[model samples]
Target chain A: MVRWEPGTAERLQKVALELFATRGYEQTTAAEIAQAVGLTERTFFRHFSDKREVLFQGQELLVQAFLDGIEAAPEDASPFEVVACALRSAATFFPDERRPHSRTRQSVIDRNPALQEREHHKLTTLATTVATALRARGVDDVAATLAAESGATVFGIAFTRWLREERSLADIAAEVLAELLTLAARALRPAR
Target chain B: MVRWEPGTAERLQKVALELFATRGYEQTTAAEIAQAVGLTERTFFRHFSDKREVLFQGQELLVQAFLDGIEAAPEDASPFEVVACALRSAATFFPDERRPHSRTRQSVIDRNPALQEREHHKLTTLATTVATALRARGVDDVAATLAAESGATVFGIAFTRWLREERSLADIAAEVLAELLTLAARALRPAR
Candidate 1:
């Protein structure tokens, strides 16, 4: 039987990121991660399916925040309003404290094609989850899909900007959302 | 030295698709595809890097059509209009005759996660290409990215509908574009 330990998952994740940043993702091993944290490989596996999953630990919370926000939105809110609110609520998931770690993780992911693919998959899943939530809220199919995808797009642009600039995620998200709405308004403007 | 043959690539693609549909994608081999086409595996490699490439043969033509349409769009066209025109022009690339083949290929791809990832990657690349084209036309970065991604979303929805229904690709594309515009208009409308 294995002994249970406190903060094993968090410790493993921090150590794994440090190792990946220093030695590169491909060169790092799960055994090395566990050894660095003074835990068994079994403990590491119990937390993350693989080393790559360490970088995506917050995905579940992000999705939940989005869904919860949509669910809690005002009943009469427009589709875009609901999505905007959901995004604003989800922004809190990435608080100021986590920004540095997220930036580091994104940098590591940027260097690897496989990690990029996984990230894209995660974003796609998030969009789908948001769409389902919208549908459940009685929004029509196409509107729900477009709103959810638009939300995902805004999140991506905001997150990238937040990483590079000093703006908060909420501020960046609000700015991006307004920009998208403006773009949409211009693009959909009636021909004279 | 291998003898050059006419229609070899087309023959290989047809034969490969047949094999994939009948025997499943994972079960089919490059050797089997070449053997069925009465060519060596060398010829198959010359035509395609791998089996999955056969399913995605039209990606290049699709990208080219989108780029050409964007380039040829009127100077006064909005980013969304440019993308709409580009999508309409690209619709011609998928006439009714090819729908049956595309439907089969899509069915095969839908069953496999790896193929879906490749398809998503291809769509992402197309969006980037379209965004680059828009940027070249003097559109701002954020708008260009949004327009291009929105176009990709429209194309995906239109293509899926075209495959399932009897509507022409152009008709389906136009309808989807209009719906997107309407969605945008409603979503972006100022709160009363």
Candidate 2:
């Protein structure tokens, strides 16, 4: 059995991401990632199932943040407000220091169809998690789904822009949420 | 070259879906689908690249309907109005007669990860297409994306319910859109 290591996972993720960025995700192998971090292949498997999982390690933490934020919001909060708050809370998971890594990770994902599909699936899961959280908050099915999906959309748009622009994730998310609300207002206006 | 055959693609899709529903998607093979339709495998290849394409054949027509609806909307229509109109127009693509087929298709897709990923990709493509149409109508990027993504979200919610509920697709879609607008309104209101 491999001995317990404090930063093994983080070290592995860093080395794997660098390798993926330099040599391409397809060109990189799990053994190379493990060796780069001075760990055995078995040790790498103990931390991550595969090389692709390094980029997705934070998904669970992000989901927890979203759920906690939603559950902690005021009882009177609107569905959209709860969603917005949850997204804003989740934004804390991605520090500005991680932006460069995120940009590289996204570039890698964009080049690979499998990664793109995984990313889409991740987003879908995130939306479903948020929807479930909303339902727990007494929101109905349609409203919960709408709010959760809308929040996920706002998060995606903001995350994309945030990767390219010099803005805080929270600010970007807030701006996108407001923009969506404005569009929704315009759409709701009675036909002239 | 294989001679053009009337309704061959439809017949193949019908057989493929039936086989998928009864025998399971993974258990159903392309050869089996072709054989069931009384056609050679080569003939099946002429219509669909693979078994999955049989389920996604309507995507193109739906996209076209969305584009056409956006293009034909009154020049003064808002981005959201154009999207709402486009979705309403696309509803005609899913006539009542097609509901049973769609239900079966969705069940097959839900049980398979690959099919689910394809469905998500298809939705993403639909959103992108709607965004492009809105941009062509002089809508700004951010607003167009918001409207387009929102429209896709509404379509997903409405379509899911329409599959299980007795209401017409158009009515369900309109109601979901209205519900989203209402949620947006409440979220836009200042916190008490």
Candidate 3:
């Protein structure tokens, strides 16, 4: 969807979230969203199933990109390194210029409880997809799940930092993975 | 909500989840859910706002319990110790007999995309709240947030394992935290 009509789809997402933040999720309709974006209802429906999906348009791509990154990792990389590479790959997935739209999409998600739930589902899907990718690369069982999950956790911190801090996504991700390692070390204190 | 109504509300939740799984969330109504559970529509409304709320009833208490655990920790405990204690507090927050309902709740949540997102928001909220709690306990800025998020990350792995695996929640949390720490130690090795 982003590839087809990047600007229109992103603009719809931004306008929809703004409306969702101010006017509320259910109260706002497809027409209202399209009008705000200067698009027709048919154009709106072309990109989104309904108003709720505007927040989730790029989800499929994100999940696929995560899998692709894992599969594309260097053969010598450890499972953790493979996951770290996936986090780095996410840097190119979303356009940096579209932070405002991304922020608005988040705002709408924050305001709407249902949309918030869907967002979690999206991440979980990404995590599972990641795990599958890892398994394909010969890392199986709990390790795959854990690595994939670890990747998602790192991704969450990175994305949050990207939202709040004045840094590139890669730096934010690197910082999070580093801190996560520190915490994980602290968590594994030998029984004393 | 759990402290007050307990089983009646839980019964509604289970029944609603079954209905939602079978009939779809959009097709299911409050009256139908109430009928299946032998409760009145009025009682159903009392317990939940909509079909979705039924899926996320007890998570708030879980987050609250995490906060309480952090606040109740000894004066000199490190931020990591405080977060670990908070994760341990879930044992007291949920009773032993409630385990079945616990899995059922997770199953229902797993089946529904929307419910999963709500669960994720609750998790992110829990992490932030725990970080804020640690700050109040005298931990400084980046360290406090890092500790909180790391705890949240470990807790997530623990919680996900607890829900899926037959092991006790406390046990899985302890193991994941331990393993994550080992992983982090390896990651933090200084470059030659």
Candidate 4:
């Protein structure tokens, strides 16, 4: 077995994003990314299943951050409260220093339909995982699902805005959550 | 070009779902589905790009139902109200007669990871399309997105329940929407 190198995945992901952004996702190769990071192709494959997997590196950690937030919430917190904590915790996963990296990563994904689909799949997974976590907290099925889905939607919209705006992800996510609540509270017209 | 058959697509979809459930989705072939429906393989290709596409045959119509719901709403309806209309409209697309079909279709998807991914993608597309329709109706971007996403979530949850319960899709969807609003209104604990 090849000895694992600390920070190897992070370094490779950074280099891969840069290459994907500059050379076009379709034109770049996993071998090229490995070479750029001064690593062998086998080592790159060790860290990621493919070039696409490299771009999606840290997806598990992102989901964990949200889950961690849920775990860190008050024992008696409401479903929305638990989700808020989870979102806030998730926000910390993307600090100011990571903004440029995220921007570049998102730009690369935006240019590729497959990447966009993968990103959407990631968010869907995040929602389901979070919902399961919420249910574990004794939140009922429907409430847990709705809150978790709402949180994922808020994160997605806020993350997109954060890429363009100067606001912090946490702040943007909070605002998005508030707006979602406001929209949800709006009265619907009577069914004809 | 071969002459179009009015009910060819629907008939093929029904037969494909039946075959996928009994014969196994992996074991079934597009040619078999077409032949079962008394048509040529070329006709099958004409209606659907491939076997996978056969399962998602009504995706466009489902999306159109949501849009039609938005269009049918009152001109001055609020964002949530507009989504309610859309969900109600969409529910009509899956009447009682369609439940068995949907149940079989969902079972096939549940057994196959690829079909599950495609189903998730379809729902994502539906959310984006509904959001765009909301925007075109003069709703702000954030409200439109939040409402559209929320609407999709409700539809998903209700659809799952509709498959198991005897209640109508529209009723289940309405209850789900109301429950979502109640969850959204719950108080959040102070951040740490």
Candidate 5:
């Protein structure tokens, strides 16, 4: 999706996170955030339906894009491999410079339950979409669900590492995914 | 910690899920559920604050109880050991025969974004709480976070397995945690 209101959405989100941290998420109002950005409540609604939504708009896009990518991926790929590749493909959407902003956004979501929940919904939706794509490619329902949901575990690791300033998102993602493959191999291994 | 309105909650959940399946989640009303249950709308509100909350009330308590178990564990235990033990301890709270109900409940949440978000909030809160508990036991923040969050990943695996009717919740949880530990150790293997 194109960025509407140009920098206005990010501006409001930045102000909202700052206000939420200082004054608390519950204490901050959309009106206050909009006013801080020299915009009206109507403008705030136009950008984000609610303060919680501000923390999640990019994530929603990420989910949709990642799902779309999976749907368009080649047929006959392993379910986990397909979703993993799709997850990696999303790296282009998150540049190295976005790390600081990404961490700050996570912090805001971390502090508030409502925002956190919205984020979780987006994530779960992404996983399910991946699973559906897998099923379409001939993976059974059980394996599809496992592949898609388990892939989120690796994604979470990549995402957390991406937020750190030192490692590039691409590098961290590669490392985490390599580790996830290792983990999966071990999970599939019978106790010896 | 306790099971109040056990059969009522379980029954209401089933009827609601069936309604959701047939008529869609948004169109279903509290009045309809109440009438289906041979209860009044007041009774439905008494059990659940709102229609959405109905699907969510027990999980927070469950995760919190699991965290509390870990925090109260022996001081010298490894992080995974504590979490695994905590999960085993928490198993005492589950009903003896409710796999079908559990699966159905998850299906309901899976279909509804709002409900799914609430479930995510509960899960993230549990991980944070588990991390805090580890810190209280003198573990540092990063390791504790990794252990706590990874423990949750294990729990997620165990939870998915438990929802399947193939095995009892307690037994599947034990096996799955073992699987997670193996997976985690591979993911976090120390450099030689």
Candidate 6:
């Protein structure tokens, strides 16, 4: 097993986001980011593959959290229940302590169209992953896809709100999921 | 109003997809695509801003179809009803006659990560456009977002099926939307 360097990656990510935010993502270099954290350029490369990777670090862990959430749900849980569990579980990855960091990271991503596209791609991948997990649990293909994609949409909206609001990420995600369910129900109602 | 050059854009897109498929997207150039269509590079530039644009031509029309669908729905239609109407309207843009062309275009996009990212971005934009249209019709913010996103997901899955199945895009999208609603209801049900 690879010995994980715990704080190094997190430190590099935090420093990189700060530099990217202040100097502009395009203006900042890997070397400059590494220097800001008192690390050598080579040390920075050891933690991240590229400058963009810094902003996207921990994505795998986030995806895994969603998957783990799926795994942790009750075996007899409804598809929506499974998804709700997953969202609540994934929200643990972004506690109150991470709000400022997330906000800065989002700000950096928003200014760059390329980064925004990358973020979109990531969310699409997350939805696909969640759908596959549901399928593994015996959910039908279309149903699994709809639930997973809806879950992704809920998570995304909630995450954005969490960055700006005082509420915890878990609380925000739960409320968002409830709102989504309510909206879906309202839409499904027959027109008078 | 500017006089439209009929058949030019469609013809260029066809030739470009063929070249991108057989010759590889990276190997083909805008000039070559134009030449294959018996047009000058300037004319090609007039049709598309870049080589990648050839595969994505008519996206604006597709978005417009969705918006028009929203507008065509009854003023008192539920959010889901509005989305369903929009999806059906958008399906008219992907008739059976266009499936082979769409398949070829999608195949070419599948092989290129950059093109895939562009497609994701386009879908995101479509959802946002649909949501805004719903909001204009007085749908609540989260309801509009959920309905629009669900509509986009239904469209995407149905479009994939349309490429391979004998069913019309409209039929497939309507069925898919129905399936999604059913899934959402199932998930929302209290666990036994």
Ten contiguous residues with the weakest lDDT in model 5 chain A: A183-192
- What DockQ do the predictions score, one after another? 0.56, 0.81, 0.30, 0.66, 0.12, 0.65
lDDT of each: 0.85, 0.87, 0.74, 0.88, 0.70, 0.86
Model 5 interface DockQ: 0.12
Scored against the true structure, residue B130 in model 5 reaches a CA lDDT of: 84
C-alpha positional error of residue B74 in candidate 6 after TM-score superposition, expressed in Å: 1.4
| iRMSD value for model 5 | 6.2
Task: State the lDDT at A97 in candidate 2.
Answer: 73
Steric clash pairs (candidate 1): none
Among all windows of ten consecutive residues in candidate 2 chain B, which has the lowest summed lDDT? B1-10
Off by over 4 Å in 6: A1-6, B1-6
Relative to the unseen true structure, what is the C-alpha lDDT of residue B152 in candidate 1, on a scale of 0 to 100? 89
What local lDDT does model 5 show for residue A176?
61
Q: Report clash pairs, candidate 3.
A: A117-B117, A117-B118, A184-B181, A185-B181
**In what order do the candidates fall by DockQ, top score first?**
2, 4, 6, 1, 3, 5
Give candidate 1 regions above 4 Å deviation. A1-6, B1-6
Ten contiguous residues minimizing lDDT sum, candidate 3 chain A: A183-192
Q: Please list the residue runs of candidate 3 whose C-alpha ends up more than 4 Å from where it truly belongs after superposition.
A: A1-39, A52-55, A94-96, A100-117, A189-192, B1-61, B72-76, B94-125, B140-153, B156-167, B190-192
lDDT of 6 at B184: 67
Candidate 6 i-RMS: 1.6
The reply for model 2, stretches above 4 Å from the true place, is A1-6, B1-6
Q: Which residue pairs clash within candidate 4?
A: none
**Residue range B1-192, candidate 6, lDDT tens digits:** 112245989788878889989999999999999999789999999989998888887788899889889999999888888998999889888778778888898999899988887897788899999999999999988778888888999998898889989999999999988887776677778768
Q: Candidate 2, residues B141-174: lDDT per residue as tens digits?
A: 9889989998999998899999999788989999
- Report residue A117 deviation for candidate 4 (angstroms): 1.3
TM-score of each: 0.93, 0.93, 0.71, 0.91, 0.61, 0.92
- Share of reference contacts found in each model: 0.51, 0.90, 0.32, 0.81, 0.00, 0.68
Candidate 6's residue-wise lDDT over A31-141, tens digit each? 998888799999999978899998887688889999999999999887888999999888888878778878999999999988997897788999999999999999988
DockQ for the candidate 6 complex? 0.65
